[model samples]
Target chain A: MDVSNLGLIDFHAAYAIQERLVAQVASGEAPETLLLLEHPPVYTIGSGGSEANVLDPAISVVRTNRGGDVTWHGPGQLVGYPVIDLGRRGRDLHRYLRFLEELSIRVAGEFGVAARRVPGKTGIWTDRGKLASIGVGVRRWVAMHGFALNVAPDLEPFARINPCGMAGCPVTSLAREADAEPTVAEVAARVECLFPHLLNELLPCETETEGGRHVCCRLQVARGKAPLDVR
Target chain B: MATEITMPKLSDTMTEGRLISWKKGVGEQVNRGDIIAEVETDKANMELEAFTSGVLLETRVTPGELVPVGTVIGIVGAAGEAVAAAPVAVVPEPAVTETAAAAETAPAPAPEEPPPVHLSVAGEEAVKASPAVRRLARELGIDLQTVQGTGPDGRVLQEDLERLGGAGVTVAEPAAQPAVAETAPVAGTEPAAPRTELHDALPLSRMRSAIAQNVSTSWRTTPHFSVTVEIVMDAAAEVVRELREGGTPVSYNDLIVKACAMALFRFPQLNNSFAGDGIRMNADVNIGVAVGLPEGLLIPVVRECQRLSLREIAAESRRLAERARTGSISQQEISGGTFTISNLGMYGVDEFASIILPPQAAILAVGAVADRPVVRDGSVVAAKTMRATLSADHRIVDGLYVAQFLGEVKRLLENPVLMLV
Candidate 1:
């Protein structure tokens, strides 16, 4: 995972970075990149989104190609845009999404938040509503646009639109969930740091297993250790 | 024209779905019959396909966010033209507004319901606590179901309960209590609060959940009944002992598989699956031997068990079972089993009932061969006895037929030489 932190960047600028990185990755010009940053306030809807979801027409709404209904990306939220070539991997998009979710869940667990999967729902959830939202697009099997986990974000803009196209769906933050206000960088660093570790857990390393398959994957990162305070 | 791609109904029970991931990017050319996305429904993860040949336009829904069925998730249209024909207006500037910032101070998402305190589980007779706390509390003669936990999800912590009150509050007389025993909550109560605790949990793997879904469906729909027979294994045990002693190692389970295959002839109902249209009697008496793995249970069938001699039966079953354990067993090996045998005899389990695999009519649960007293002629004498249970799908297998089939198995096993031939 080639991860870059473009701290507190403009939404369109970050999107350009994503596009550039995606093209580079697809062309084998650069390695897969995971771009993490906080976007200034913006309401983005997909092409399939209904205008009815955008309550306040004045809010800067960028129509994106990413999957999902309208969503809010602002200062406190850490938006991760992974410009990764999926063809080199299994090219299984659903499994890739589940890996992203598992990464978020593990990151939440580091902060003592009991995040879980709701049966039919997409996002990582606590008893509180969704804690994060994920949307991505792929071209030639190269993925772009990723997850947005609420860190210390102002969730008020979420009320302007039916977030995730569902009315009255409550969005939560890492700080709110953990009851400690950690910076978006800290959460972003944590999720970025834990991403590959969690990815290998779900996707598995089949090539290594080929040598001797009978032995179970006998490795675990020691738990109950303090999360590295990368803030 | 850019056409909207809405959420497709993945299953009968599906009301909502999570877009797991998108396979197509904006401006990516996609043809009809190409899979464009994967959505997770209540039952399983289903593949979503592109219905029209076009370039992917825009996706409206993000992965991990749940939306209802028929919610438009993406659009597809002619590539360069679609980019010009905007679906929705991109507002120039999102107003950083007044009411929005104030809305933060408005109220936190419905001031979350205060977390609940843990309560005692009554009639369980055992304290609802962790093994560590439950043991510690019992050593102090304290009832676990009596304490309220302050820990996460109301789980009783040892430190919290230890600081409750007086130490070693003996509920039972020391003379009456046995040493190092799992204390059951007795009738009389010197109870304070019931002990409640929670343990860590991991999400069930897809394999585990699939096993759960399949077996649960089998359990709910099938009407099941079990019949037991204790065959005095004096002769059968001798046959096994002789085989081991003769350097050809074979197990009692192997002998039983052979016996069951022979019994299939006497009772053909055991070898047939009940199709809704009619009973499909399989020509081959392929026996499925249940193999337990760390992840889940698998049944590998040893085909044409009746044709194989006792020695051949032993080798084939072990090979199939070993492959099943190593996770290399093929689809053909796992399927077409007309009968199944689940043995916990090695674990010292006696006469345990088992569930029948779907479509197949019967499963034999074999128990340990033990030395017990049985009447021979007039007086009760010490003899080796083994219990075998037949859990049959009652829709097809009648009780009397099950009895006759079990009787035949007993005769075949007790006359141990019959299986060798």
Candidate 2:
């Protein structure tokens, strides 16, 4: 896995990088990559998201081809785009989402903050509020549009829209939960350190039969070994 | 042959998905990799690509329609080729409902002879048993067609299998079963095997029925282990009194909820649930305080206790309890409890263990805060003490974790000011 720390980049620039990396990885010209960056104040909605969730008409919203509702992105938040080819992997998109959540959970844990997954909801959360948001887009079995961790972002923008289509959803950050305030780069570093281990543990390469053609599919590592697979 | 396009499984956990829109219209030429539709799975929306090239012949489902995976949503075939009829057995219009004039003009086709009943032929007769009962019968090696159903409409039931098994028939019990003495206690106590005059049977109220069913389910499924701790509630009582004098109306249970929230923050395992094959760690410490009513009980939750102030929790718990007693509580108020606190302190009960609430890992049972003799400084002394037992699912947390959680709760209650900080 290749980790690039591209700090303070525009959302569109970061998305373009993700698109390029996805195409490269899908074509076997590049290794699986992790692009870490931060976006200026912006609100983005998933392709399936409803426009009615945006409470404030003034805030500009970017519609993207991802798998979640409207969410906020800004400088204080750490955005990570994991460009990986799922063809050689299990090709299970749900498991890929869980893998991203587990990465975020470990990153939060590195800062002495406890994060967990709420049943029937996608995101890593603390008791205080949700700590991270994850949405992905897959083109030809290549995943993009990864997760955003609230390191120390201004939560005011989130109140302008229903975060993940949930009304009155509370958002929290590492600065609030941890003993000391941490920067987005610091958190992204921890993510880069933890991503490969979790990816191997949760979404390891395996072989199984699919379409009755002896096509190799990934079998989940034993559930006990992969605790995050509880979802 | 026309190829049917079914909803694709986009995720491992998605049982069904919504068809957001069709990218291609009927009669549109489609290549093998053409995007045919967009689907909203449980996680996100993804484009559904065609696997084989053909012209779209029919659209079986409309946009925004939610259907189970593998349900055919469209048909694709060569140009000018007619699509095959759907596999569903189309029911013809009934001749029985026809008027007398229509029947006289054209004699209705002679009624087909009814097929001979073959009890052994599976799929010939539709069984009325639920999926669970059918599964149980299969596990017990009992054939549903042979067993006489005692339930309404002659439906085979779980109890029928039990009856068959007890009769020493074809049903085979698992080996290595422990032998129980005939003198074993059934239903706790059997009234000393003495006859008594029978009274009129009374039906269970809705609340009672719910309680019975819930507790039975919890007892049967949850492997519960309890740890008891004695806490000197002198400080907690003083804080409660101070709050009550200040018009906050704080109760002992409210203090316990505050303390439990703090302890749960430290030990997230206690706030977890025993999901099969793994555990679900709940992010919010939504403490459900069990409120006893005249008929039964209602546990109204004080949600996200980690964010609530002590005074706020007191007010919410009091309001919920009042609403529960008045039978005016909303569903949202009584649901989403990550942990539960059941107190019989008002009734002056000493101590008791509660059944672990399903999905939730643990329940804290708080006893009355009363004066009790304690040995302090190697001498007997009276102190305002209470006994609290934590019943937790062993599958999620062990006795050590439960003890540490209970100890933290005790530490917070004993040092009541720590909760404020």
Candidate 3:
């Protein structure tokens, strides 16, 4: 899978980028891609989710065609949109979503965060609360609209929503558990760094990685230092 | 009327703070200047005070919960007010102000009609796992509906797939010879069934989790550079042997600690930490000796290493490590380390660099000291020597400074009398 760090893009622009990349990858023009970026204060509702899930009446949102409930995304949150072609991997959508959640759980494990799957739930959770939300859309076996991890965001935007239509639990981030607050870029670097190895172990696409099982590429995601460019 | 008292943001970066303890309880008279509760922020523990003079109506937050600032943690209003359904006053986040401003320009678009849902019937009932799990099952050709779940509410955990090949009867039934050889183990001739009966998931202990998190964060964030040097331990070993013979029972580790203390005194710059904001040079020379345990490694720090003699350092080191191994070492016993020395000498490790512990600028990874043939003064002789690698955070200690510090340590270890004196 190709990973690109699109740091700090607006919601509309990122959505447009995903749309463009999804079409490209679906048609075999562009490589199967994972776009990592952060959007400004915005609430999003999937096709079937209720707008009422956006608790704050004034909260602005952009409707998208993805599977899940309403959720908020902002700065300090790492949003990964993987336009992966599952034609050769597997045609099952649930398995693909599980891979995304497992990938997230493994990354959180690196940070000493015990991120787990809540059995019937479709996201990642910690002892404190929900740590991540996974919602995706597919086109002819090409998956897009990936997962979002709360890194060190203001978290106030989360308070304005029920957080993926879940209730009675708080939303937590890595910074809250971390001794020193981590920046969005630092987390993005780790996600890009660890995701490949995890994908290799958890779900290896034989045609993609060749003989190399370990994706040990370390990235420095500070503005200009990161391997992947921010667009 | 009961007014909700919410969690207050103590700092700019603090999105949430844990309620350490409540100074007052329900129905207690809370006045201005009254420290109603103590909240622990990322930086420090702060006092949460009451602004209005009223009775503590209710405590919405319990101790140890890290809630967002302005969450309705308590109610401070009139006496006996019916707070049956306490209104959870949502603490407006600073980011919400930006969202609200954006709302005016683009008012929330009216609720759109729900899109048409497409439910796939392919393996619908058989797909009894999360999206990630189902895909892996399909890839491995293991049916999920056949696998027993170990997760909450009979949910198929990620680990259930491990037993899919053996325990799963239906999936493996069609694979040529069937699972008949696996089921009808011919009287102790089954090679003990490969010890793969049950699938188990081991949860991480708190200490293990802490070690993983701290080291991972440090390794990722810190820019480290290591310098290795071979130091002759003939003199230090003689001193240690002499001490053990004298009934003090000191080890090479104690001598190294003392030598490090003296070396740090000589080169104070290497003892400083790279705090990201600025370099902090520690006043007292405290050396943390890394003690390996089953759970993980614990570094118990020796305070005032400069004042303690060889015997005292040895005694204290033994006491602390013994306590740590026996699970008696408290947090205070293991904290506040300036520099660390990790010895893999006992394990026969030759020489390896280690990750620099966070907030501490440098750490010394000590290797085994044994009889090795070496060229001494041009002639090869069997000499007792130990190799050490010092990994220093480049953000704090300069290469020249670390080299000088390591040089001094080598000199002190070689002489062995200067530090003791």
The top-ranked prediction according to TM-score is 2
Q: What is the DockQ of candidate 2?
A: 0.23
Cα lDDT tens digits for candidate 2, B1-421: 4555666565556545677778899889988778888777655566777755779877776776665555556767677665443322111111122123322332222122111111243641476676545544432334566578899898877778655531112222222223343445456554554321111223355466567767887899899999999999998889888877987788788889999999999999999888878777677899999988778889998998999988899888888888999888865577779999999988899999999777899999988899999999999999999999999998888988988999899999999999776
TM-score of candidate 2 on Cα atoms, chains taken together: 0.56
Docking class of predicted structure 3 = incorrect
Decreasing TM-score order of the candidates? 2, 1, 3
| TM-scores of the models, in the order given | 0.41, 0.56, 0.40
- lDDT for each residue of candidate 3 in B96-137, tens digit (9 for 90 to 100): 111223223332231111111112347445445666555444
User: Candidate 1 chain A: worst 10 consecutive residues by lDDT?
Assistant: A206-215
Query: What does the lDDT read for residue B32 in candidate 2?
Result: 73
Output the worst ten-in-a-row residue range by lDDT, candidate 1 chain B.
B110-119
lDDT of 3 at B217: 74
Cα lDDT tens digits for candidate 1, A1-231: 578889988888988888788778868799777888988888887644557777777766788766666889889888888776655443455656666677778788887787865423566777577898877676655778888888888877898887876657778888888967888878887977776555445544221121322212233233323232110
Model 1, span B3-23: residue lDDT tens: 456565432234446677787
Candidate 2 yields a Cα-based lDDT of 0.75
Q: What are the per-model C-alpha RMSD values against the true structure? A: 27.8, 14.7, 22.4
For candidate 3, write residues A17-80 as lDDT tens digits.
Answer: 8889877986879977889999877788765566767777777777776766788888888999
Backbone clashes in model 3, listed as residue pairs: A94-B131, A95-B131, A95-B135, A98-B131, A98-B132, A99-B132, B7-B70
Cα error, residue B82 of model 2, in Å, equals: 4.3
Specify the CAPRI tier of model 2: acceptable
